[model samples]
Target: MNVHTPALAKAHRFDEPTSVFARDVIHDLSRAPKRLSPKYFYDATGSELFEQITVLPEYYPTRTELSILRNRSRAISSIVPDGAALVEFGAGSTTKVRLLLGECRLGAYVPVDISGEFLNAQAQALRADYPGLAIHPVTADFTAAFELPEAVRDMPKVGFFPGSTLGNFEPGEACKFLKSARTILGKGARMVIGVDLEKDERTLYDAYNDTAGVTARFNLNVLHRINRELGGDFDVGAFIHRAVYNRDRHRIEMHLISKKALTAEVLGQKFSFRPGESIHTENSYKYSIDRFALLARVSGWSLLQSWTDEAGLFSVHALEASD
Candidate 1:
């Protein structure tokens, strides 16, 4: 469905193929332990697989966070000033943002994502539903620097970063990202972030290793993406999905282990993997409420308020940028 009631939303591309994806793939695969950025796991196929993962019975973060949003949307909207620009980072299906849009009278809505086509389609759907809302979709890596649309520049900006995606980054990188957001959104801007709380090892393990194997497919799809986009010769079947809870690190680690010794070539470089060798793919760090608050403080944000589900499996915190 294409809706042009509030003007056609324009998409801006900042992640050039030769510069970002290809370069990062070569560099990351060349590393000692061998790793790929989680950001790469969001191609069209990967993105669709992830949406499936969120609904799996074992995946509690999605539903738990959604409950908090649905129940507290008014309380959440109260903090955001009327006519403020809503800038969402890593905007995926645009599902969660719809809850905010229902209550907040946003001046403009900007959804930033790397998957341009998928993002544009979601934005168009949103436009049809909210005809009066100004929707500006930016197709760019939210991690890297990118400019907001000129139209939203003068409007007060409120950042929305849900889905516990902050857990993907290590503490240091997460801090850097928060600081960057502070600069981009400017002072007085507030950010609402979803964070997965530290929970039982069993729960964490089950969440990543769903019984339906959707998470496994989502993990393996990364290799398919590498082969399809970077010209990598990967025997996708040769790798098995593995997720383990790292107690000392307080995180769940997702890896793809080689089922047998094999060699794969990408970007004209061949790499050999020993039997059982694994490429670290993703990490989801669980944080306590206090721990995350400390992180926000260090990153130049003061916590305004936080909401959690009855089980406390997930949390959504509103943080105001400190001057």
Candidate 2:
């Protein structure tokens, strides 16, 4: 397998950022109730921290999802047409996809992610392991519209969006994304996605608020990235990390609370944080199977089949495009 790490000279033509990181930081921080897009949390350091988070005993999503994929991969692969291109959204580490790749004779593999360097490195390692497989790594925000390489354009596409990452999006945004994917993959294409099921409050809370503090670091690393890339002065220690289940919203919300009244500078602009004010960083939504199936229907996918662990803590659904 030949590994292609094409120069990102034209990356900006696709979904690459056109504005400075500072601009987004300033705009979001200046909002009434400040919030940041979770996409920013995947810079090299943040990505590493998150990888650590997945392994911590308190974080069950990764291990549980892996178990489901491992046991069901053969059945999962059976539905995927031979020679179908496997396109994964937010392909971090490319670990879970390995299960399916081992079972399926795919025409090509496309892993889309925002972290270019990380994505390339993982893709190269995969190339060495799967020599016969075609590996095309596209470093772009999977949430935005981007073109698939011409190599996979003719092949039937099977989208793999595991890890319940879809839970990060608001329902409307998720719907829009599903629509965009339908356009990209065309009719009859299938999408296999992991969905975190709505469980007990304590279970959900512990998953995000890990005992290891890895998740906390993962959340604060956003501020660290701002300090490094945007020349912001942030006293990382001045903020307390928090993760709470919002029962009404059916999601876990992560925030950084200001320990004291303070002012921070970014891009030469000052923003003030009152004591106890929180900058909302991320939200991970959990869903019931019925709720998700309803979402899939409205989003243009027919829920073909779903597999769950014995405990029903998580689920993976195989959905076919209705159009």
Candidate 3:
């Protein structure tokens, strides 16, 4: 796959930030299934809401993944070559990357995220904490192929994809993402990824359905974004957050259910929803160790090592690009 450069992205009409948001929202809401891309869930408000979700008592993935990272920092850092560039995909917050920065020897840090506002603010904060480290922030959808900064092009690259963000993609897309990442990072590159593990049904449900309603706000923030950016008039309060685990798929599905029959307009187009109708928002797929290992192998990566918490709630893996 070719890298999507900033110039190339601007040349396409659909690539315009507001145009894409308006187009996708109208097209998706018109469809029978009525679904939206989870990528839209990262405007400044959405990003802030998600950070809150991570700390909620019902959420376990963040804490569990952090524990694994803390316990295995030495082994994880060993894979990084000195003077290497760490490129993080969908890097919303600096919380997890801080651990790696403290432990690893690196030349620069590149955070690629869709939310430019949040990304810049975090980059600014990082600069204050790590004065010597070079920080490059790229504002683009990480799901699509995107070029790294020219400054870091010749440096050895290590991909950091934490927060189980890989789970947000469908299985096939996840594999495609690994392949795309391999292409972006180039040969001899290494990746450290975090994956949520299959666990009790209740645990999966609780994580997205937090009692404090932070996750709920995070889910609804997409609609809020549509309103703010695309001149949409959605009754954000008319929808309720719903999360359920699909056993066969081994993923938690988050949806916004309509409280009543309602019509919403976006970009001068109207879409109607029936009572109980849902707009599917996000999916968090839990992976077994063997399954994720196979995913990496087929996507041109070799799983070098994996670490898990004591209860096996989450996993962190070290991967090497394979020829």
Candidate 4:
């Protein structure tokens, strides 16, 4: 199978005899006792594990997001006008998308994801389900500057950003992402996004470090990724998983802490970890409604509608590009 990546893609995908997109940055991050970004967790196995994570009793983000979509879908359908392409940023499972397509008269469906293999498979299924609707699947990092095709470029596109994935980005990066969407959609583009609201620490803690053990696998899988991609030695069993709420940051942080002092090498790089030293894996930030609105305002998007769950555990917001 051939993957058609842009000029930049070759530098990123190693298997294609691709050029490396890093100046030792990849090796630097792969060293244990170091923190890495969460984007790398979508490797095939990690993606499947995340699907399992969503269903666990402790993981409420996906379930809660689905609930909001179900409760307000009719109103959301009414608000987002028809004859417009509904574009999702990281269209993973696309659990909410089926509801949108069935409830709303959408002209086209556009999904962008880093996992092209899974993305194309889902796109094929989506195409079969909605033969009348156009499916333009794009394989690119959502954080990059992408050029839309001519047909999609001219449509009154409405962005659907569910999953509270925006929280994954650091504050500045998140703002830039919102701004990029505005630049692409231009003035008059409507958007509906999900933002997980801040809740109690105890509740947040269990969601990431679940009793089911799948979340741990997902966290450690990053190390496995290093071993496979960059060549690393991660025992995958010599560490303990941790998740905590950083009150100062208002985010849940996941960590893998070494149980004992250990030395390991990966892709020709040596690393040492103390017994208590930890590698920060990911952070899931929960926002207050006011904070989220401020983020949208500062990013050049206007909040049209915002609704919280009956329990106020999550929020679904409708926003539009202002400039």
Once fitted onto the true fold, the runs of candidate 4 whose alpha carbons sit more than 4 angstroms away are 1-33
Superposition TM-score, candidate 4 onto the true structure = 0.90
- 135: Cα error in model 1, Å: 0.4
User: For model 3, how does the per-residue alpha-carbon lDDT over 215-315 read when each residue is reduced to its tens digit?
Assistant: 98899989988887766799999999999999999899999999999999765567889999999988989999999999999999999999999999999
Residue 188 lDDT in candidate 1: 89
Per-model lDDT: 0.89, 0.87, 0.90, 0.80
- The sequence of per-residue lDDT tens digits that candidate 1 reaches over residues 110-144 is 99999887899899999999999999999888987
- Which regions of candidate 1 are displaced past 4 Å? 1-15
Could you tell me which residue pairs clash in candidate 1?
none
lDDT of 2 by residue, 1-323 (tens): 00111222133232335243445666788788998889999988888888898888988889999999999999888878999998998988878999998899999999998888899989999999999999999988888888999999899989989997899999999898888888788778999999999999998888888887889899999999888766679999999899999999999999999999999886556788999999999899999999999999999999989999999899999999996
Candidate 2 regions off by >4 Å?
A: 1-20
| Quality of model 1 by C-alpha lDDT | 0.89
lDDT string for model 4 (208-263, tens) is 87898999999888788767765568777898888888999999888889899998
Cα displacement (angstroms), candidate 4, residue 88, comes to 0.7
| lDDT: the better of candidates 3 and 4 | 3
Provide the TM-score for each candidate, comma-separated.
0.94, 0.94, 0.94, 0.90
